[model samples]
Target: MKKILLFLLAISSPILSISQNSTTSQIDETFKAYTGWFVDAIFYEIPFSDTFQIPWVLIVLIGGAVFFTIYFKLINFTGFLTAIQVVRGKYEDIEKHGVDNLYGEDAIVEDILKANQEDELNVAGDQTPGGDNIETIRDESADGEVSHFQALTAALSATVGLGNIAGVAVALSIGGPGATFWMIVAGLLGMASKFAECTLGVKYRDVGADGTVYGGPMYYLTKGLKEKGAGGLGKVLAVLFAIFVVGGSFGGGNMFQANQAAAQFTKLFELTGENSGLYFGIVMAALVAVVIIGGIKRIASVTEKVVPFMAGIYVLAALVILFANFSLIDDAFGLIFEGAFSGLGIAGGLIGVMIQGIRRGAFSNEAGVGSAAIAHSAVRTKYPASEGIVALLEPFVDTVVICTMTALVIIITNFNGQFMEYGVEIKEGVELTAVAFDSVIPHFSIVLTIAVILFAFSTMISWSYYGMQGWKFLFGKGKITDLVYKVLFLLFVIVGASISLGAVIDFSDAMIFAMVVPNIIGVVMLSPIVKKELTKYMNAIKKKEIAIEEGAGDLNDQL
Candidate 1:
């Protein structure tokens, strides 16, 4: 790890020199000149009529989500309680013992008995049960790395960042309060999309020789589609998804996060200097490097702690502002509902409002974008659908809960129309959100700044793992490949912080959303497989309940 860090610094020194020679503004202009066309091309909107244009990517994301919701019989709603139970370890015994063991399958039962017999011998005096013979016993839950809760947090860390804080502000500003209503609707529908892809992520995952799990759209698109006799198509989609993920991880995941965190931190502290960003970048990069170098287990461990803490702080702050303006709570919801359908002040009326809400919600939660599936695939579970069920909660938490909190705060604060004008796009979304927070609570922008930094830090570490997985898929997995990816990732953090490259960030954002194309296509194609896995997991849960009930009856009779 020391050598790797040294190598990263060594490689980044030249780029750092180049950035130093040119002013930050110069770099921004140069990057925009070079990448403007790419950004425009990727974000090209499809026109249904002269007055209405929608980005094709948003169409794919929302359409896929709606399809999944209906096809799964609204699993998002029906499976909500079950998802909580799974994360809480309600089905741990079934997951650990394998479904076959619950039905008293002779082969599995015999292995358990044999393992117990071997434990009785203890010839080598190994006190641990089964000792050297333990490998003979199959633990169904041992395949993956992290627990269901850890994977949820890791994925949540990636999605619940700047988008909830800044992006929601932008959406509500343009579409008025109506956008918030549609955003929640989009979030609820998106739950099914997350369930489908994550299930496939686990179903078609590749477990390495050393038991490291490699799973995501890349794996499932290739392996899942091949099972359905579309190997050629699957391989192409997988490669495309992998390339997009790596690019997205670098720009949107790593650099953009560092850049925003640095901006918010420096501005709040009144640190105005050419090198302030560079200095903050180094510190931020160093902190991120420590967490990411430990790989997924370390990443998961850090995120499970950071995500909850940061989210709790941000949510609590929002709650304070909400309760303070309790009188306006009804009015805020009234605006949201009225604006959603009436679209009185928004451009293009109801269509414009619906588009803004759905677009922001889809982008925020990233439900069908396929990135969350990469993180969810790492969960330790024998039943793929168990993790998939848990994954449905991500969009709910990110968009429905957190984003809603942000919107309500913005709406209630804007009752006097002092902060922003309706129907106008707000460029400085973070600042606008901060103003809303600071209005009711004195000096609350300081807390908002801290939350932004935490959001950026947690986001960077999780995305590092996502990008590395894609890197390994393209280049063979090895120590060198891992080192190279990490070095580049860390370097991007500095570059992102030191320079403001709007065009570059826009391109990366496009790459991130571009992922929706291949992912939605592949997941829809493999929906049947997800359904089968869901059925298999549900049956196991039912069987476990029946067994428990029968045992209780026998004990009652004896008593």
Candidate 2:
């Protein structure tokens, strides 16, 4: 703790002592040469035509979402209602039974006999459990830290941020109204990817002796692949994923969030001069440090409250705007379809619009990115697929609902020619969103500003946990190592706040999108594993229900 404080003081001293201009300029230069080449390489785009170029990374993301959607037989659609039920704890007993009772006395006796047989075989130097049938026994007495609902919210807190507000605006500005249609389509498709990755997250997780859960793509890629006799490939992919995840934590999850929050806060206050962002960053960093130091359990507790409240406020505001312009809603839908299919004279034609929409939609919900899998892995459930089912709601809420709302408001606001022409460059994305809200509600800019900060805060804390998992994977998990990573993360928050968006946004975006490469590769390799887990869970539920019904029928017969 003392070293942590000293590190903070040392990094912050420059900000306090130097002029704001000097600080900003100095900080910007610090990461420029170091990160530029890496960012450019990862985000390199392949042009199909002059105006319809797509990033290779995005193709991986979109393709993964599409593959999972098809391979999973549109689980996103079929499981939508089931996902809500899971989050509502409707099937919690399924998890409890597996953990607590292990299917009651029959299962216990069977397990004991199996163990005795295995022991005898081992005594003869034969063997014990082998193949895919050997299950990792979980300690029902020591369950996970957070509930399914809490895990959902914790992951949601990270995703439902400026991406919904600012990213949607950017997509619209580039792709026109048509992008909205494709964006929704991509988000819906993304639900399958989320389900696949998260189910694997819980299936391949490691619970420490102290009951702490260690999971994410790192665990799944390594352990799941090793089981398939590809240990070397799995280790390589796991390391690559850890590297990208950590970079993403600093770039997209940390800096991008801080940068946007500072931009909104300073703009709202009409603060001028260099010191505005620097000071705001310091305060934001301090606040982030306080929460992250407590780790995921504490983070989950906070997000369960903040995610719902912030989402409700933002969604409620969007609802009001939509209701007010109820008559124009049909017209808005027309523009979205026409713009998507016809392109409405937009550059790159329909293809350009589709690319922009899909890109932004994927970016917004991050269904294929595999970050949410990390959060969902911590849920206290014996059935891994239950959390995966719950995860289907994330892209729906983040992209289909919240992002579409933002797009509608923007589209509606532009109907009067109050905003720039479609496909025109948007200078400030969030500010553009704020303008749409302000057109309806007086002084709503303040509300939007508050929402931005809260979004940034929640996202930072969640990302911190994600990055810490990666960090622990690379460096051995220890107290000093954790503290060091946390301190550096908080410092980067300040750096994010102080720097201009150009390099920071580019690097962060690249780092985040780069995560798709290794993550999807691993998920695709292990899709069969996730499918097996889902089948097992469904069968267990059926048997339990049948047994219950038979017991109830017997009771009625007796009565």
Quote each prediction's TM-score: 0.91, 0.88
Write model 2 residue lDDT over 1-559, tens digit each, in one string: 5644564465446445433444445555554555778887887899877767888888899899999999888999998988887787666655754622434335443454455456555645634332111112233332566789989999999999998988898899989999999999989999999999999989888886555778999999999999999889999988888878887898789988998899889888899978789999999998998788877778898999999999999999999999999999999999999998998778888998998999899988998888999988888778888889899999999999999999999999899668757878686888888888999987899999999999999999999999999888887688988988898899889978877756656777787777888899999999988888888877866665666666622111111
Deviating ranges (above 4 Å) for candidate 1: 1-25, 103-141, 552-559
In model 2, what lDDT does residue 196 have?
97
lDDT of each: 0.86, 0.83
- Give per-residue CA lDDT, model 1, range 272-317, as digits (tens): 9989999999999999999988888888989999999999999999
Q: Residue 492 in model 1: shift from native, Å?
A: 0.5
